[model samples]
Target chain A: MNAAPPPERASPAGREAPRSSVLVAERLTRRLEGEVPVTLVEEADVQIGRGEFVVIRGPSGSGKSSLLYLLGLLDRPTSGRLLLEGEDTSGFDEDRLADVRLAKLGFVFQFHFLLNEFSALDNVMMPMRRLGRLDADARRERGLRILRDLGLAGHEHKRPSQLSGGQRQRVAIARALANDPVIVLADEPTGALDTKSSGNVRDILRELASGQDRSIIAVTHDLHFASAADRQIEIVDGRIVPTGTMATLEAAAAAAKAAGTQTGAAPAS
Target chain B: MSLHLDIAFSHLRSRRRQTVVSLLGVVLGVAFFLAVSALMRGSELDLVARLVDTAPHITVYDEYREARPQPARLLWPEGAVAIRGVKPKAERRGIRQYRRKLQTIDAIRGTQAAPVLVSQAIFSFAGRDEAVTLSGIEPARMKGVSTIDEDIVAGSLDAVDTNPNGIIIGRALARKLSLEMGDTVSVVSPTGNVRAMKIVGLFETGNAGYDEGQTFAQLTRVQALMNRPNVANLIVVRMQDAYAARTAAAFIERSLGYKSVSWQEASKDLLDALTVRNVIMYTVVGAILLVACFGIYNVISTVVLEKTRDIAILKSMGFHARDIRLIFVIEGAVIGIGGSLLGMAMGSGMMRAVEQVEIKPPGSTESITLPIYWGIDQFALAAAFAILSAVFAAWLPARKGGRVQPVDILRGAA
Candidate 1:
């Protein structure tokens, strides 16, 4: 399994990704240390290239979000290595990893976790202020420009509670792009939005990848959302299953369930 | 830093009632600390100042703390010699070679010495007899060493220079005898010698017993009447700095071979009581601030708990754990500084109000306003203690806040 090439490289759609890989994982695994010892993600191999929009799809409890967290440096792997912008991050401490995340990556959670007390503009400027690479005037100006570009020009002063669900998610995205991160990771970005708002958020994330030359990795259960991504990776039972064999494996698992016993499907030869 | 402060202020503002209540605790603690300490320290200093100003700083008595060694003991060397029931030799009771001793004491810097021959006497005026203490003093020297010169209500202490037989008696004594200035009274000493002494001056020391019994005459006149001429029994020394009297008295006793007692040594019991009082005062004040700090700890702890989600979001945004901790600590500091400033002002106002209260003490004829010490150090001390306690109180909760794992909170929220 470790010798197998990453599924993105074998897929015809992956040929469109530029050769520059922004993030790569080599058999990364994370196990929760407890008496039960739950394996959240195991042997996850992935490659996200520049300007590529990747969607991770899996059933509930399949560790789809867990894998995205590992790639985003929000969670450390128990074993194996993760590389961000060609820098091996397994040796980095928590603070060093956070620094890298602040400088190179952004995140949008399932809930648009904009600080409720702060105005939308201040929320967007938070990452910029934390990075401290830009002066106050530049940060404010850039924050205003980003919010305006996201169609939230006049609503920058509104608090999160005052904004609509879709507007709040847009602010979260604006905040994610505050420091001009090389890659943006979203977990169920449009999960809480209506159909129209979900479509709007999907378009914005796709444009951020294709138009701005930044990578976007999203974990979504919405097939309509997944269909718009440049490539799709499917995970099952904490392992990434190749798209070619996923149907046969699902059918086998359904047959096993029908036979009055619950077990994992055998791997396709 | 500004971002942390912004979040801290936002959190505090969101819970305005709790924040203000914690702030009020600090304010009241600091105000009461200043007010109570000022009163305690003020009364202590006032009592010490009265004691220092009214009495001699150091007194050199014509006495020895230890017995003189016998000639036999001096000669024995290592021999076991026992001398029993040996009667002491009779001697005149006075500081021997007084003029030379006076010159020696005069050589010491920052000191003024007055020679006094204190003797027991009886005053008889118009068939009334009063037992009294007759103190013979040189008018010019006594003026420099004694507060009696300031207490003279009739003739001056220098009147004894013109009339060798003149005596300065207290007003209470003169009133009891129905005697006026220029009235002559017969004074008889323990040695049976008698003299007709004119009442030339009068003084009132505000001490009824002393005013009724103490009499002052010229040194020569007292010596002549007592039949012990040239004998001065006591050397009263006053210093420029009363606080330096203990060391000066020790040095004087070493040089002069007499028992020297500083004012502080004489009133040691009173000084010890004041020290105990100061300890109690500080403890009570410190406890007040400690209680105030508990309020701070409570408020910050609640904020940390309530803002757990915010903390998690901030952490995911790449904020370090210290940043989360800093926001809460800054909240504590803001309350500390703001409350301290207001408390100091309130305490000063309280001090001013206390200073306006006038009361007549028992046996005192005049009413005096309460003393309120406005020392800057006490204000600074209160502020420093309150702020430090507030920070310390914030630190406990801050460590817990800093230990918050973003993953745990994020997972829980999800």
Candidate 2:
């Protein structure tokens, strides 16, 4: 397992290497409740490399979301090692964990949890506003840019209820990426989306992962999404099963595409 | 901080019903607080003014000793202890010197001499004679030195000067004697020595103690009746500042013991009642403010609940707990300041309205009419109380908002 790990390159003094894989968790464990006390992840060491598209696939109770939460520093593990941008996370309290999460990670929930009060642009601008360094014009500019990137520029003034499900999800994604976090963690992001909407969101996630070279660890039950990742990790009964990479998944997908072409025009389009 | 305020308002705006409820709480609280505060001030000012107008700011009395008969004085026991009194015996010999000492007090306006005589006198007015103790004061000196001048209702004070044997009396006393101005009244001493004085005027002093039992006459005449010429038993002093009465009286007593009493010390019962009323006013008004703050707490707590999820999300976004608390505190402060201003306006308006309604005394009686004057200090006090209540009410909710955990609330545990 290469226990000593690699000698990571030192970031330039006073400058963090952009797109650093800022989250690491090894052998993470969580107890749900009761005397039995289920361990969510045991001896599970996962490295989400910089710019890597890491997809975790599992069934409903496979603790896939739990691992994502642990990596995002939203929940503490009963016992395990977690390093956020190479700093040991065990010593971090709730407040310190919040600091790490706010500075380094973004989250997209299965349900698009948009704060219902604010318009889409304001929702995206909220984190920056709370941080309070930027003036009004700067906040507006940054918010518009993120909204524009998410294809939500036109819907920026609309409330969440006025937007389509895909648009709402995109807004949530924009809000998540507002801080330009080092990593984006999505748990069942497409679970509420239709096939078309899901594919659009999947495209957005892939772009975020590769073009921006932001590390993405998405939890999904979708085999195709998991297979399409730079790496596929399977979890069953709270432990990860070793898996292969995008090259193998691409070959398999291509074979499936070819086979499907003879029968129907590739499902939707 | 501005960012937190924006967030706080956004959260508050998100729940319109709750925000309105909270704002209503603050408004009512402030209004009641200010109203009660103003009422208390109005009542207190009226009482103090009444006292200041009718009562002497300072009074002086004779320090007396039980005169010993000849045998007891000649066979006086060795080392016989004498009681120490308000004035020492040596100072009592030169008592007139004490009146001069009162002049040193900056607020001493003037002094009036009254001979408090113990001789039994029969007062025959409207064909009846009743025995009473006689008190005498010079009319001009009384007008110059006491509150008696303005208190005269029916007749001129100069009338007392025109007739050497003239006297002024309380309306109740005059009614009891069935006498009017210009009616001659015969006063017979216990020794069968009689004198007649004309009814000069009638006065009403509001207080029952003075109105029922007091009569004023020319000082020298009463002095002759008491068999002491050019001598007064008691001297009443008036001061420019009412608050300085007690201090001045103390200084005068040390210089001339048994020679003076401040209005407060003379009328302890009345003064005590005034003090108690002041305390009760503060307590009752304070309780009203407390109730108002309670309402504010109710409204803000609901606000805290409605914003819990937003607070969690904000916390997750790296806003500290202190920041969350500050947001709610700002909200509370805004409500407090607005309510306080509103309360002050409403209270001042109420006082003005009250002052405008003329309270006429019964049946065209020439009596004292009291007015409620709005003082600046009253408004400041009410505003201060309202603000304190508002801040206090907001404190608990702000703390609860701060303590909310982001993950717990997002997971619906909060």
- TM-score per prediction, in order, is 0.91, 0.78
List, residue by residue over B250-326, the lDDT tens digit for candidate 2: 87667655556787776789768868876887787777767766766776788788767767777766767777778
In model 1 chain B, where is the ten-residue run with the lowest total lDDT?
A: B405-414
Each model's interface RMSD (Å)? 0.9, 3.0
lDDT of 2 at B186: 91
Q: Residues A229-256, candidate 2, lDDT per residue (tens digit)?
A: 7877777668886564333544655877
- Candidates' C-alpha lDDT: 0.89, 0.70
For model 2, the stretches where C-alpha displacement exceeds 4 angstroms are A1-21, A31-38, A244-269, B64-134, B138-141, B153-213, B266-307, B358-394, B409-414
DockQ of 1: 0.59
Clash count in backbone of candidate 1: 0
Q: Among these predicted structures, which one has the highest TM-score? A: 1
Q: Pick the candidate with the highest lDDT.
A: 1
Candidate 1 regions with alpha-carbon error over 4 angstroms: A1-17, A244-269, B68-91, B97-110, B227-229
Native contacts kept, each candidate: 0.53, 0.51
